[model samples]
Target chain A: AQSVTQPDIHITVSEGASLELRCNYSYGATPYLFWYVQSPGQGLQLLLKYFSGDTLVQGIKGFEAEFKRSQSSFNLRKPSVHWSDAAEYFCAVGHFNKFYFGSGTKLNVKP
Target chain B: DTAVSQTPKYLVTQMGNDKSIKCEQNLGHDTMYWYKQDSKKFLKIMFSYNNKELIINETVPNRFSPKSPDKAHLNLHINSLELGDSAVYFCASSQRTSGSIGEQFFGPGTRLTVL
Candidate 1:
């Protein structure tokens, strides 16, 4: 069974600090990787995606994710955290016509 | 213009009632999907329709039926809605081509509250 796991259920970072959210997936082959952010009472917005080529992918709102095949991990990172960045982050793996999403990681930005 | 849109942004209904959530995408994608987000904010894929054809159906209750009238529209109907069904439902669309299903465009979710 292919599945996605986000070990960190919640993370807190101070404003202007670096942030990293971990994600791991179990798949037979390299799969499409994605990162999405959802704010309170709002729809999810795609942050970045990794299909092929360039292992490093940049996404909207100053977010970037790197796909490491050996580790079977796609971790999301940001240089500096903003108060506005406080939200739920989800890591997803896409295969064929379906997608498997991780439970989610909630980020709380402190002042 | 919204690429993907869902009707009834907020729905408050009683248990055992049947309701439908409509979805439409103008991005010209051939694949559409239905996702459910629980109160814990866990997102799960429910169904996927490509060009009005069912392609993927996850482990969901039979009470949850999805209808795709056309490539651009996918609707989800729930029968005997239970309190456990209260959650946010999202509609999404993507293009599947050459073994690459790109990123999905999501609509503003419909928050369903069954009492």
Candidate 2:
């Protein structure tokens, strides 16, 4: 079965420090990758997506993700983190009309 | 304007009660979906409809039934709501094409609390 895995359940990063959240997926075909962020008491917001072409996809709020097919990974990163960046991040794989989301990783940004 | 919207931002109900959540999208997408987020924040897909046709149905209980009156609207009705059904439900929409599978647009979500 196709699934998405986000290894870190929770991560703490100092404001202004670089950040990286790992994601791995298991699928048979070329997967459509996506990153979504959810703030406390809020709905999910799409960060970025990778359908084809460029491996490095940039998203809103200074977020970017790189899709590595060989490693079956699509990791989200930011050169510098902000206090507002504290939230839960999810990785999803889209197949046909269905979507599979990872458990999610919570990021805590410290001032 | 919100591309996707859900009604009843928060709902508190008792077990055995029946309730429904409505969803609509203005993006004119061809597909709609329902997802449940548990207290632990684990997200899972429950159902999907493409152009008002059921395309994907996860292992959700039969008590949870989805109705798509049209391509732009999808509603979920839960019968005999259980305490375990307390969670945030989100509505999303996307456009499916041969070139690319469009990114999904999510609503603000409806937090359901069944006591």
Candidate 3:
């Protein structure tokens, strides 16, 4: 019933270029959405979350995401790509203390 | 200090062997959870406990058993390990109150390798 989809399996971008990772969710009610980044062989770190209020949410490591209720999408964006930003990104939807995660998108940055 | 900690960052064992992974959270949260991450990095929730009471249990193999000694400690024991059991296991905690399931804090994760 509730699910998350990250369409991009892999993305590559040159340094200083803009980056966008797409995500979409399927839920009955307003979803508690989150973005997490996982480095190679590391645990996931929370990037940001969208609960209520302003649609644009800022996160650590210079990442930001916007929640669009009409489209059921919460896409992550970055003004400039960094070499260190190359990692796996996941989008999750939480409800009643449970989370539904997407397949994840792997980002590759070329210097 | 680590907010959530798991013992044995890496484990390697043969098939049919029994092993256990211990997890502890010092964040004083009310809820704890265990998640399994496959080689493809797909995270699936295994079990969850709130104040030592089982609250959520996903469709996991019976070979996997979770025990909570107290509110802060949760241990996962697996019997008769198989190659398919080899994956990274993560323990996370969150403070859920008044129907608000807040953000989760995860441990470093334990990488298990079964031969």
Best by lDDT: 2
Model number with the top TM-score: 3
Error of 1 at A106 (Å): 0.4
Computed on C-alpha atoms, the DockQ of candidate 1 is 0.78
Candidate 1 regions with alpha-carbon error over 4 angstroms: none
In model 2, the runs with Cα more than 4 Å from the true position are none
What TM-score does chain B get in every candidate? 0.98, 0.97, 0.98
TM-score between candidate 1 and the true structure = 0.97
> What is the alpha-carbon lDDT for the whole of candidate 1?
0.94
List model 1 lDDT by residue over B1-115, tens digit each. Answer: 8889999999999999999999999999999999999988888999999889998899999999999999999999999999999999999999998966889989999999999
User: What lDDT does each candidate get?
Assistant: 0.94, 0.95, 0.94
The i-RMS of candidate 3 is: 0.8
Candidates in order, TM-scores: namely 0.97, 0.97, 0.98
| Interface RMSD, prediction 2 | 1.6
Q: How accurate is candidate 2 locally (lDDT)?
A: 0.95
Candidate 3 - CAPRI tier?
A: medium
Candidate 3: TM-score of chain A is 0.99
How large is the C-alpha RMSD of every model relative to the true structure? 0.9, 1.1, 0.8
Worst 10 residues of 2 chain B by lDDT: B96-105
Name model 3 segments beyond 4 Å from true: none
